[model samples]
Target: MISNSDISKVIAGVKGQINEQDTSLIVAHLPLLEERLQYLAKSFPSETLHAIAIKTNPHPQMLKHLVGLGYGLEAASIEEVNMAMAAGCAPSKIVFDSPVKTRSEIDCVSGLTDMLVNVNSIGELNRFPSEATCTIGIRVNPQVHTGAPEMFDVSRNESKFGVAISSKQEIINAALAHPVSALHMHSGSQMKDLEVQRGALEALKALADEINATSSGKIHTLDIGGGLPSEPLSDRTRMAEYGAIVHEVFADSQYKLVTEFGQWVHAEAGFALSRIEYVLDESRVFIHLGADFFMRDAYTKARPFALEVWNDTGEFVQGEKSSFDIAGPLCFAGDYLAHGAMLPATTAEGNWLSINGTGANTYALWSRHCSRTVPKCIAFDGVHSSIWSERTTINY
Candidate 1:
């Protein structure tokens, strides 16, 4: 069994090998990622299909590991589809699930392997190429929003994710009329409620039954698109719970039960390492190191709960435990990552702080805001670590 001391040693050893000037660094815990995938695989051993959503981090090593474990890719874009292919994932092992697709993107994906196209609208269904023999999936909107309102507001009618449950029959009828093959549903993003997810599965199973009754060809696949919660929040429902839910919902169906879990698979396996550059005053600490890149990285805004910060130095100085704001090196006022966050009393500059929820290549979401260079990423197999990505420098 690996103890905390062992993990700490591995972290220290990896940190020693990297350049200190590289402010933003993401480290992937490969062993942990593999372990979670293996656990999921075992839980749903009867499942014929398990696809990893490619949007989370898309670290090549992570994708390679998933492919090695006999998992498929659930890609939402052409780039992700290409990445999966480049990583040795065959077309048959990929599901192209972009509900809102451009004509050109559809043109590019057409005739590419045995891909599953997830259609969100009747217009998209009408646009599907007649010559393509791909399995077609209709993404049903559960009309139940499950994540942070700011991040994925699916409860409101304004949200444009999938076709509503009220319109599921029409969608299935259209697919059957077109002679397409599968059914799909995605309640919302960052889904933490098992009940909501289960409800979606129930709705999907009903849709599948309806399709099977109407169409001569069987509804072969039932894809539960990626939205599983991760990190500090997913504790509400264990991965095993999710597996059991899937099993119960599709108990007698012959349909291949497929789930696209990206965040839950890779979130815990990554750590964002940042160093304290300087402290402004006793009242405010300004240890500017790396940028988290995406505005969505703030868990409080994305998941409805604030993330707890950990100081690696183990220094506990006493001051007011009041809220403190954390900001990146960017120039805009919106550059703040965390605001009104509680920190240690004696948090000082030059102390290393590592955010536990982020993963390697997490900074890939960073744009050239304020012309800041992108941070580097490193992969660690809990023992053997290597620089997978280099830190970018400002170039004219």
Candidate 2:
């Protein structure tokens, strides 16, 4: 039910001031972020820890905003853990779920009273002395594939994410042996099927039951990790239905539930702006640091940002359209925004391309392949906005 009219207005306003020093930037619509969080809050049970996955869009200002909203933090790295702490996340509100945790990292967080640590591997568990005080949890692979890309699919049989539950006995023994009271399962991100998530949970449920029968204590928590789609313009009724389905599926579960959603909450709230350098031809249009801005999209075509064209004057461009390969300002031939984008034929340098659906993974997953400066991050609140982070960033 959320619209981008406010965001559109902000972008249009920015167009009028293209002469400003930082014209090409991304805006995180604060209102949209709050709206999405509120919607999810209404959808899920109040007690559920709606943990924001730190890796999704770890803009520090966003983290501080989330903390103010009383949302929990699901950190995947030590830096993220520190970011969460810096943003005022209580130790109890943080969940550590990194795939590779070093000895020093483990040692540092071991004493935090209520922080949940989802141990990644059996080998890592072996290194943890029984005396470690943090709440112990084990990441379980349900071994239920969701047909996502191999790189993002963590439940695959050979995934490096967690202990693969090839059999019920395997995960049960691992959980009991490791002194784990919590079970975490992340089937995949941007999953095509909610049913797959339910199936994974069911698989974990059986394992939990096995542990309860064989061990002295019951599983205390269920960390259903991220993968729900967070598109702002998506059908709200259908999304509500999806939320209802999730509630219905887990209504009878005994343990306290936790959901980690990085993209679903933030993806639609963000946008990227790029100044057109020049159009090479009808087939090629070059923009600044092509691969540098959207490394994942330009390289692997994982989440190519949707585009809307506006003139340097900030007016929307509409006319006869032509397919243009949007190229980045990189030396590589493959640094293109889109291979066959149908754009206005009148596109030229100084015109701005407002890239949409960039609130989630676009900047968070970027790589400094060409040593380009990280685009400044802006936050919009109504008609007014401010630069949230202009942290100096570049690579030699």
Candidate 3:
């Protein structure tokens, strides 16, 4: 994780570079991202394909950075697949897990040799070309509710994500009918319980065992979707424990392992900087960013982020704190980043705020309702900060 002091140092160096017109900036720490990769390496098997979800931070430079680090990319759409390919990810290293892949899109990815395509539904399985060289699998919703946030959970009985394990016969028959080589399951993100994850994996393994016993073709891969809550930055004990669970479950199995982690890989590596524009009544503080860049945090109560204040001189502000409603400059009333946010009473209009834990699912989900310019991002390495991408305008 990137420390507040680390960010403060970077901001102090680049404070002059930020002009009066710039309202926001995203700081991505390469060292923090590398730490995530290191944790994943320590947790999973050496041969496991740790496919980093591209949706988290689709910055072109970030994509190329991950690919160059020899990490696989998990694409949720055809465009993301193309982006991964363009980033120089090997065809075999890309995993296509889109829920609604059209026939044209199917044909596009099916021709790629050694690609793993996990069909979201049984009906969608028939859309694939009969003699495609790419490997195929069916995504099974283990139906094990992990008590994850409702919006993120896709393993319910009637969920639209995958073939439910309740339809065991249908799922088994589909695997036998198609040239399926793997089975996949993703309960949801922000799931903190390891037992819930264990249950889901056990369910997947049971189905795979049954399929292998009943079918002529054996299941060779197990795509246990990544939903394990990100561990605290202080230590990787949670990851080590999760790895222990994974080893206990599949240590003796022949199936290859693949993990598609989005938030876990990037959540702590990035943070956003927004300029405080107003201090209304010393309670409702308005910042330059709101629903446009913080879609989840503004609209949902689940995605909470931490805030740190820095004065106009770029020095960290620490003193008596007070409760304030941190809001964004959006048209609607619901566009609040946090209500009753505790901050230094000295926080003023010229102060800059760092929104922490925004490295994932923040900017990539940028909304166009307000027509705000997407913030420029700078990658920091504890020593220097460099421009990763320029601010983007929606006009083009």
What residue runs in model 3 are displaced by over 4 Å at the alpha carbon?
214-217
Give stretches of model 2 more than 4 Å off: 1-8, 12-23, 214-216, 232-242, 302-304
Q: Which ten residues in a row have the lowest lDDT in candidate 2?
A: 14-23
Candidate 3 least-lDDT 10 residues = 228-237
State the lDDT of candidate 3 residue by residue for 1-396, as single tens digits.
568788787778677777887788888889889987888877887788998999988988999999999999999999999999999999888999999899999999888988889999899888888888888989999887777888898888889989988899999988898888889888888777789889889889989999999775379889988776655555547778778899889977888899998888898889889889999898889998888888887788736677899976668999999999988888999998888989999888888998888888888999998788888888888788788877788984
> Which candidate achieves the best TM-score against the true structure?
3
What do the candidate models score in CA lDDT, each in turn? 0.67, 0.77, 0.86
Per-candidate TM-score against the hidden true structure:
0.84, 0.90, 0.95
The residue-by-residue lDDT of candidate 2 on 338-376, one tens digit each, is 878888988887777777777877778767776666777
Order the candidates by lDDT, highest first: 3, 2, 1
Q: Model 1: per-residue lDDT, tens digit, 239-261?
A: 77877887788777788877787
The whole-model C-alpha lDDT of candidate 3 against the native structure comes to 0.86
Once model 3 is optimally superposed onto the true structure by TM-score, how far is the C-alpha of residue 52 displaced, in angstroms? Answer: 1.0
TM-score of 2: 0.90
Show model 1 residue runs off by greater than 4 Å: 1-7, 145-150, 153-158, 231-236, 288-294, 297-325, 339-349, 393-396
